[model samples]
Target chain A: MTTTPLSPTQRTTIGRGRNRMVEDRAELHRLLDDALIAHLGVVVGGHPVVLPVAFAVDLDGPDEDGTLYVHGSVAAGWLRGAADTTVCVTVTELDGLVAARSAFHHSMNYRSAVVIGTARIVEDPVERRHALGLTVDHMIPGRDATLREPTRKELAATAVLAVPLHEASMKARAEGPVDDAEDIEAGVWGGVIPVGRVFGAVVPDADATGPVPADVVRRARAR
Target chain B: MTTTPLSPTQRTTIGRGRNRMVEDRAELHRLLDDALIAHLGVVVGGHPVVLPVAFAVDLDGPDEDGTLYVHGSVAAGWLRGAADTTVCVTVTELDGLVAARSAFHHSMNYRSAVVIGTARIVEDPVERRHALGLTVDHMIPGRDATLREPTRKELAATAVLAVPLHEASMKARAEGPVDDAEDIEAGVWGGVIPVGRVFGAVVPDADATGPVPADVVRRARAR
Candidate 1:
């Protein structure tokens, strides 16, 4: 398989009227890596469907292209139909908004990535195993070794799709709103209302469990 | 302007391969209302488009016959197209998954609402005012009164659409996996793992030198 690095496309633009689109892979990776959940948009019967799913990032192995691997049941209607089909996967973090004096200038300060590409299903056993390993590790590093291996039957039912980080665009807005020079005279309550996510202390299972995993503790606190 | 209340005929059911379907409005409303954000699926050029947006519930002023009014900007292509067009709006919250002994029975515990309808644009000033109020209080309850009233210029630029909650169906999977009788006999590491949003302490604006509002405090802890 040829690994094609993504280039900025004609559709990626910044602001309301198409002003600031960032096509850098590093910026795209940063936004994707930081996001725990993503909204997956797929077409079913000509109507659009969007589903929020937990995803894992694979930065190693045959997926040397830094592919984002998302999986669901092989029987899942959305996943089953997505294979070899162009899918739009968006990861958006609304960091803040530039509330400007002019309604025309109102814009959100966000870090968003739109990946448009054909998703291919992982078929090989080795690749599937590797993908599953990456997924488990990404969800909770070091949990793969502790969890029981999937049975043959379990492997048969699972489905994993790989969407290359190629064809992706990352766009962001951070500065205060670009108010019209004329609008500046209009006293409006305008400023950046920052948005963020915070994780609380991890609540360990109350059952007769062994000592808490250090990795889990560290990651939870970091969040 | 007509406010239509959707009956069962307006509802659509999305089924898994063959077995289950849920059709309930109360369940749908709770799921949609609980979510902090929604990914609106719109189709452009016969392709699927999905964008994340914030929405609020309008409870005080019913549209004619107690229909739930969901409002947004007229400038928004999605909202504009949604009005008088067949659209699908889905709201989902993945609480967790309940693993079971049988792989086939492994299930996620989630609350989801999928509404299919044509949105109506509210042009009447009296109705529009109430819809705007709902949108404002939906985010910050008392802020509507505290903030400056919208000027005619602001209102002129804004557009609000209302989608009735009538023709919506809510589907949920909230219990432990229903493993087959044969699988139930087999021992497996199976149970539900819960997930949800936990709001942090309310952060007041640094410049807001006044006492913390009671409404803000109540809403923060209510969540």
Candidate 2:
């Protein structure tokens, strides 16, 4: 099925650097899939507070529109204030560091997705459970199946919010650093050094029932 | 040298979760140094905007306080709007994904530094150049010495802002996921899968005049 792209508004539009915009809906999904965490921006008391939270995107809807899921503690109260207000959720994957010979041209090669939407608080008990399960499964496939679902008391302590992925945009810079003519003639080492995340040594918990599960072992290699 | 810790307003205070608070100045510097990118929060036109930007922290000041430098193009005007406004610059390093048997207990092991301060535009050309040098060298050491300095025209096109580290605080969670009593008894595989960044194969520029320099080669290994 063909997916409609996210329509951009004045804030979502990349007016300054147009070349970095990624308009494809599928590409946005790919970028969000790889992101381990997302920065949720909310205006509190006339100031902006950006906090990192474990996030997941639900893509099973008919429009192929993405639904961003984020959760925090009731005590933290970050999501509580976010209800009904406009919020910006951004995910960035730093692909590499661009080392241009000219200091002015030095840059980073990264893929970022910016989504602006209203934060709809998940108040319904049924929807809350779904969002929580999606977060666990999104981070690690087969995780939700293995683990027990959230209990009523556990769900009461958690707060989840959803943002429609309709008004979103992805911006990426993947090419090598472009050094100017004079700097190239000066003979500096100019290139792109790829930067990426991978799995480090696993630390099993005290309650681990067996060796690392096969799902985790496979996920490690892919991560 | 001992640095005076940041005085917190009601908003910056970690009253809800005081256990995650880090008060040491030296530890905050180390957290900022390890961040791949920082999310800069600014309130513009009654809305909050969080954008990822390359950033550096200079801890060589006499007071042993860090000065954060974040640069953007004059055209984008992000850093421009930040002048004289309260801004929040946050750097997060995701250490691992904490997998708990219960969905509610799933968490992320991360170290995040949040600096809330008023931005001061770098008007002095001398200080501007120094901050830019520190940024480039901090990301990739020894490259600034080789590359040509920014010309006046180039310098004019860039805007850099400085936020003192005095009001900054670090919040980190570095333990295994906390599974509840019932789920721990359920005997699901619950543990922590460490996550971190590394360098992929280097891609040299097409016009390279010599082999990749020793610094870049060394940088790749440590990346």
Give the residue spans of candidate 1 off by over 4 A: A1-7, A14-24, A59-65, A93-111, A171-222, B1-11, B17-24, B59-83, B94-109, B173-194, B200-214, B220-222
For candidate 2, write residues B1-223 as lDDT tens digits.
4477643556777756688888776677777777768999887667778899888777763223667888888787777888988898889999888877777888888888888888888888887888888778777877788776789998888788888776777788999878767677777778888898999878998887788877678778884
RMSD of 1: 5.2
Q: How do the residues B1-223 of candidate 1 rate in per-residue lDDT, one tens digit apiece?
A: 2333323442354545323345544455566566655566666555555665655555334443234455555556666766676555666776654434433344556666665556677787767766666555655455456444566766766676666555555566656556555543443344444555544454443233345456555545554
Worst 10 residues of 1 chain A by lDDT: A200-209
Q: Candidate 2: where is the Cα deviation over 4 Å?
A: A61-64, B61-64
Model 2, residue B28: C-alpha shift (Å): 1.0
For model 2, the DockQ equals 0.75
lDDT per residue for candidate 2 within A57-138, as digits (tens), equals: 7786222375788888877777888999989898999999887888889899999988888888888888778888888877
Candidate that scores best on lDDT: 2
Residue B55, candidate 2: C-alpha displacement in angstroms = 0.7
Residue pairs in collision within model 1: A14-A20, B74-B159
Candidate with best TM-score: 2
Q: What C-alpha root-mean-square deviation, in Å, does candidate 2 show against the real structure? A: 2.0
